[model samples]
Target: MRSSMTLFSTRTLPLISAALFAFSFSASAQATVVDLGVANGYSAFIFGNIGSSGSSGFTSVGGSIAAGGNIYLDNYNVGTNKKPGSAVNSMVAGGNLNTGWGTLSGSAVYGVSNPNATLTAPQWFPTNNISKGNASTLDFAGAKQQLTTLSGDVAKLQSNGTVISQYGNMTLVGNVNADVNIFNIDASNLHNLTLDLSSLKSTASIIINGTATNITMSGGFDNFASFANRTLFNFANATTTSLQNVGINGSILAPNAAFSGSGDMNGTLIANSVSSINYGHVAMNGSGFNTVNVSAVPEPGTYAMLLAGLGVLAFMRRRTPARAPQAAMA
Candidate 1:
């Protein structure tokens, strides 16, 4: 009968290529997506070993931590207040920013506004305290805005514009480093990451973690201090977002909620190091030390070969035998 069905379709095409190579080697061992995005437009800069202790008022001018979206600036202490156009420093935070896109965990989530984030936009979003106003031009791209709708359909949206920054005055830890950015594509799961900076002249610490997942944090954005981010943690979202310099090792757990997805990487976003992160809380430029946690790289095993490629695809479909004889015997 047609040469025995052409010899059973050449032995079921080599058992369907060994069940798609054991389901692609168990999906490369599950959990794959750590690029922390970066490349096109380019961004990522880290420099540690910050000393010069502070307190009486604040001054540790040895910070150095940057990532970029375009690396805007309202203040970098250029001449004395990042001159040029002006927006030099101003904050009064707000909240609500969990639009789309997901997967982000490159760790760097310090602390600030935790007094229940009151006094309206207290510092500089989600949590990190702020409030260096008077300029009223600072804009971290409106913290990567996203409300959209306002005209009906989806009902009542509004927001509609912004890439990152709004209000202003932010510089996580200064003297220098604090220029974040995030927007790499291939779109897997990760949306906004508009971390604007330039004003911590008072207090603004943020040291989050990596190995990201569903996250959406937009804590009240004003800028000042309260001591928040020392608790709320959870990294594991197809990880990777490192500039290397893991201060504050494992067990990072503060950041109760945040999420966004649809990731790509063609945009590049490669520097790698999104793993170690502990509860937040730092004052650095404002004073508050204790940092540890160097470079670490683990999680290799390929998810047990993707669950052993599902029993090798059910033993190659039971050795592929019947195709029609009673529909393969039901």
Candidate 2:
């Protein structure tokens, strides 16, 4: 019902504030610094999709960031859809896992930037296998760029004041000072999220089907440093689709960044700094909230099961006790 992330802050300045209104919604800001206080007005505004879908049964993609101590938001999609040769016809629907280990379904549509953009099955419907669709298969054909996933670990000593950290993945395209660590988790100093190619960034349409993998984006000995995985950057004209799990170690910077995803985050999330979650809109019937708890470490039951199985096999092989040596008979 709840997620593991925490509250965040945003700000903007005077001149920077004016510029935010000038941005074109065709894509994200080219410059990593989303100056919300600047006065740079938009010549080509692109934020036409921002507002709660009133029974439209679909969440409109949107985004925002802080600059010069001001928050700036103007909806924008992505650079390229992950689904290659697929359709970009925007659709809607839902119901998914809370731990983020499943596929999503319903009417997930897509749109692309140019005819060259390709769409793939994994990119279009990542939760396809571990999950299902409500109406039909996922159709992310038109998406220029889609937020795949935002996960990592704190690269420094995080505290209650800051709820962000350095997250290394396909989304790390710019020089973003992610200092929004809000999760108040106290545990082993590190963050390890099961990763794979699809979990990373994508330059072209990439299909990711449970290519179960592991990657250590970053971590440290700091208490909250393990949970300081908040705030991300999406530079202007940037694409890390070919992004794989990498390492991270950095600090929080002003003018934090923002990113949007095609992944179903269709749910409401609540956190007290322990953990955070991301999923689709939470309907009474639809599944929502993929939790990430920093306090409780999952038991290594898999390892235990494997060891127990091995012991059973060994016992069966040696059904009788060892016989004593008969050297004295000679």
Candidate 3:
């Protein structure tokens, strides 16, 4: 007679292994948690050019900068406002790099040849840390696809906050105890509307989705520094985003928009192109997205294999005959 313990051991071992394999495969399928990939290290990740012309306003970046097109900086500063003792790549451009008077506290990398690129009166930390032919290492093309997918996924999330409008001011209120909160607002009402986010908790992940193809925001957000790291403003369908005179706190995700803004932003900025970003003295900080939820799903083939294994185990258990007792021997 086959012992019950032997049957259980043989059947349960394979099931456990199959279950674990499926779980691991699903966990690595798609990431729900927001990840910027290669662009996470940069404060400003632009798919197109940086400055419109050579006479653009002075700009200061708190972290690294990566641009797909040419980078024209009249008076600029990079890798200065970051962590105290960290010196990474200050500037990375896929096109030419034209600078008049600026300071790069780290290395500089440009794609074009010497004639198309110029670096004049720029003070380097390690004394002229300039290089060429490393633009492909930044991988701006991969970042664009990743950010676009992220924007779409985040926009599809369910809204969990309330939007109240009164006297040209909009207030977004969410539960403090929730892990993730989403809010949707129209792009038309964004201009000149004061945003109130004082009721939101600092530890929670906040996502603000816009509903327009062209967005122009000119308002200010209150109590933004508290939840800046875990907050994201997703402009998924925007073709052009104009942020004028607004002190933005959360990270801006506009993968397909031409971003033209004035004033200072305190988070990561991702855009398709930059006509001009007049930051004056104040610039974008490295307050990037630091937290979010991640969902895991198994592939169809792995799921099917697990189901077949279970079915075979059940059939074997059912087909097994019981052992007969011999009482005449006693």
Candidate 4:
């Protein structure tokens, strides 16, 4: 009886351990999805801190603009003023605004000017629900921390006429002569990866082919484009990102760095701050890619089921009869 009981315990323990491990892993993976919180409202552009110097441009933002810091729009247009369709979106600022010579044609501008004042504030100035100096709705700190937890591979390519480097289910294809570095990542095979090009020249064009995967890029690119929508370019580890007259296409997730350049970008921009001289455009995606939805951990019922299963296995082991004592060995 004792021998049989021991055998049962040994076999069942391994199975129970495996089951527990699988369940935990699944839960952790599901939890990686992060919620963008209030940042989701402004699809076009969102920034946490805008320096006192501010920005100036005539570019158009397709969606809304939400700023957690002071907005210095000295000489810029915030909406469309074309011939037939002369319309503007909403602009919400959490801090003060130094509206020098800029013109806002949006439906409303919140957190700026007093509602009852007679001064000729921008159209729809001091809209309702305008909160000033309030905390940002987006969880900047949480998002940065989440990026650190992501794991992936790193691929480096040397541009010598035609550079080709493959690493861990990802391929880099580009012509060094044309100064183009393209990354073709297999999203299904490799979920997380980073392209380190800090050592390469900044004149190279960087392109990414995967969407909705964990990917990060270090160093600067003269031109950047993405074929996949909802692709996130995390620059959280870098202190600053400089785009010198380069136009990029993709969402930038830089919670800690400041973006400074005289270039233009088409896609959502979530960063600590932004400073631009020329036309800098950040167009938000309406496909719900700018925001994330993090799922909660597995429910208590899941844990209960695992415990119950282990308990039943133990009970069965006790009930099983031990093999009869074998005859004395020769």
**Clash statistics: count for each candidate:** 111, 83, 0, 0
For 1-330, candidate 4 gives per-residue lDDT tens digits of: 767667766786677768877886686566334333444444333445443554532234545565555555555555442222111334555555555555455554444323322222356454342333223343434543543333121122222232233443233334444334435443322222333444334455443433323333322333234322334454434455545544455555555556555445455565666666454533233312333333334667777877787787778767877668889989
Best-to-worst ranking by lDDT: 3, 4, 1, 2
**Candidate 1 TM-score versus the reference:** 0.23
lDDT of 4 at 87: 19
Q: List TM-scores for all candidates, in order.
A: 0.23, 0.18, 0.72, 0.51
Positional deviation of residue 77's Cα in model 4 after best superposition, in angstroms: 1.6
TM-score of 4: 0.51
Cα lDDT listed for each candidate: 0.24, 0.22, 0.71, 0.45
Off by over 4 Å in 3: 1-31, 84-87, 112-127, 189-199, 277-282, 294-330
Candidate 4 wrongly placed segments (more than 4 Å): 1-31, 34-37, 43-47, 54-59, 81-89, 110-228, 277-330
Judged by whole-model lDDT over C-alpha atoms, candidate 3 comes out at 0.71
* Tens-digit lDDT track of model 3 for 86-204: 22677777877777666777787877322355443344424357777553467667778888898898877667787777778777788666677778987454754333545556567
Residue pairs of candidate 4 with colliding backbone atoms: none
**Model 2 lDDT per residue over 253-289, tens place:** 1111222222222111111000011322211111111
State the weakest 10-residue window (summed lDDT) of model 1. 147-156
Error of 3 at 261 (Å): 2.1
User: Model 2: runs farther than 4 Å from truth?
Assistant: 1-299, 320-330
lDDT of 1: 0.24
